[model samples]
Target: MIKKSIVFAAFDEEYVATIEFKLAKLTEERASIEFITDAGCLEAFLERPKKIDVLILPYGIMLPHPEAFSKTSIYYLTEEEMDAENPAYIYKYYSVKRMLEKIDSGLITEAESEKGTKVVGVFSASGGTGKTITALTLAHKLMKKGKRVIYISTVPYQDFTYYIDDASVLGTAFCYQCSINIKNALKIIQDEIKNEGFDFLPSFKNLPVSYQMKFSVYSQIVDYLRDKNIYDYIVVELSSELEADKLVFLKNCDWKVLLTTQDKIAVGKLEALLSNMLDFDRNILILCNRYKYNQPDFLSGAQLLQKYEFSEFIEEYNAPLDLEMTKNSQLFDRTILCME
Candidate 1:
């Protein structure tokens, strides 16, 4: 007898969940179920799984950049073929059920080969800078502006929660309630966005420093998002302090922003940081966070723009930084996010 398998390409979150629920109802049966959200997970899963039986694909998965469908048994379910009322879209629900039955009866063996996902990493170069704030702010802004955004911060101290305080937190408790785990955090983010349209995920929590995260894990998360077209923007925040893992993540970001100030030491450090990114297609945009013009000689924003050729990218105007908030609050509620 041929081994049995199940494959699905879920486009939006609702459809993914609907399929998952239907698959769950079949738990009493002996067949094993392997669900894939996007091409990233599909490729990653295919690399490790012993065998594959049924392949279900999201219609939009291969549409963005047609190269995605090169060698996969999966086929498209065009909009005309899909029906909202029918679980299998445009086709009759039982037709899909019968197709699965055929697979279980030693009909289909393996799918044609296909591609993987793309990723965008975000990192910064110094301490006491606004790396986390910038990541959170940009992700939040994108989401509010109607784009799907997945905000992630690899810093273990957990600052993302505060930046998106208005939204319900997806913390340990929430994950437990939903039966989710950190290893699947990226998948969960995909699921949330697929269903809810946008979401955020904190870095792996409660880990001892003895085992720092490998860059591979970060890459996997980035690939998952890219493969699924899960979000319009993927904003990542690394610790302001440098580390091996930090460098790994920075190299992966499509555009790297170096947050800095006019302080002599900070400026010197930033110059050195730029020297390191010489070969990458990364932009070293300078973010002047919590700035104030206290001295007569201090350049106005425009003058700074001319002095610093890259200053044109300065994102927003904000009140001076409050040293107190930086040191005392768990929320790290900066004046910018709090702005009405």
Candidate 2:
């Protein structure tokens, strides 16, 4: 078995260098990666007789003879919105994990029969970081951006009735768990899917039932959704109660958004969470809530995806609050999809 060769060419060494550094440490994949900053260097490398399985280049760097490398998979990197619709172009500025996925961009296309959907796990180390709100808002934002999105809250005891409409599916997810085969699973999921502005699984009847779900069940659900190629993103609200050590299913997600606050205890929890994050250090996006107060000394200079210092906080979850009517609705955009 021959190893695949993956090469990246870009004028900005600093930008591409960061990606190279992250992927190198990510894992020892079955590929040889070379980053070329100079066009002459890339030209000389291309002159080699060795196999070039994949080549990623910026849009401005045109290839004189593209047909020469018929066997090579070429992709263009860009940051502009106009280029997003192109199949050959990938978003240049993205998290390492997301960048890799964009390298295989076919997996996230909306077209059926293609590899589709990205799972975003919204998690927090401490309470009151508004993790659930962030997850629901992410789904809404992605939907508004013309991408298909589904929200799933794995909080166990209750559903996301506060942020979304509570049209019950009458224990559809429970039947899915008991399903024996993929056909049954698909039929059960499709039969019960509810669209509350965006698609979502109601998990259970709109009741205060304590139903504990395993990570394997969630994994199967993700596989089923990806198999259908109907969704662009799956926003999962992971329970913070699972904590850092017990988050065994974290790796299943493509991106993990960890919400935090200026609270001292939250900082300690983040420190613990960051300790075992060797696998997804670059894919973990940190967002601060009530950031007007202050940042913890540890994350003082860290690059945050977004920040909020709301003048008013929703202290109670007993009432259903309409997030679309709130100021935070403007907090999300297509840019929020980017990791790191």
Candidate 3:
């Protein structure tokens, strides 16, 4: 069954209600619709603007920025704005909608790779190594390059959404709540490549009960994405508990980065994780997060490399994690990579 979504936008209270009534009629046919009036608040509107297929901007209200209306299709009251001496309001809405339609339609025929999306997946030995922070940093760095990035986290907490300055959550975390079988999930992702220019798909809300059962689905998704050659990169912030099937999913990436610290406990767990993956790829990069220069007890990456007999497969990077800097810098119009 094809489920439809709609957004209702207008200023006049009675007119808004009338449109809502019409939207309700559409819902009788199983359309998923939402209303965005002065009451719905801008944050709420922006959070789910795509749900609105047709946006009916009402008469008489003035907007502060022309850019605000760019996310949807617009229908304006041609004479209502003129009568109220706010022709600019009508003009702005029309302009924004027209431009969005142009880009949206162009996406249908456009090639995916030309759009330039970079995706990087961030994994860690355990929970506290700042995996989400690192993933957001990679995304922020790419966005700064004037490239589009979609940041997604497989972990339940999903702190990635907190770091994005002007970002919106793309798909629901509880993907399984919908009709998201493994096949459909992969299809939606590939379909969005040309449509959204660049976007991210977070892990399903509930990890399937049996890891082995999910592989065929994961493989299908990865194969589709790899074959399309669309995104410059897709960053996956992985969960801590490493499973065999999940590791198979990791191998599909261009780079499967693992973050670790010099703490004996941390490095030990990372070693164990890598040792278990006998077929681990060569591209695995070991990042030493929160490096301490003076603490001799805390081994340097090279020293750890020599001690662990992992000098062959692991390349270490020393960079201290700065949470505050990550938060503030993430807001700027671009993404930056700081190597120490």
Model 2 lDDT tens row, 25-57: 442454567888997887776666246878888
What lDDT would candidate 1 get against the real structure? 0.47
Model 1 has how many clashing residue pairs? 17
Rank candidates, lDDT, best first: 2, 3, 1
| lDDT of model 1, residue 144 | 48
Task: Report the C-alpha lDDT of model 3 over 112-158, residue by residue, as the tens digit.
Answer: 22343333557886767777767766665554444556555566455
Error of 1 at 11 (Å): 46
State the lDDT at 160 in candidate 2.
68
RMSD of 3: 20.3
In angstroms, give how far residue 75 of model 2 lies from its true place: 27
Task: Report the C-alpha displacement of residue 246, candidate 2, in angstroms.
Answer: 6.4
- Candidate 2's C-alpha runs over 4 A off are 1-115, 172-185, 206-212, 243-246, 294-298, 301-321, 326-328, 334-340
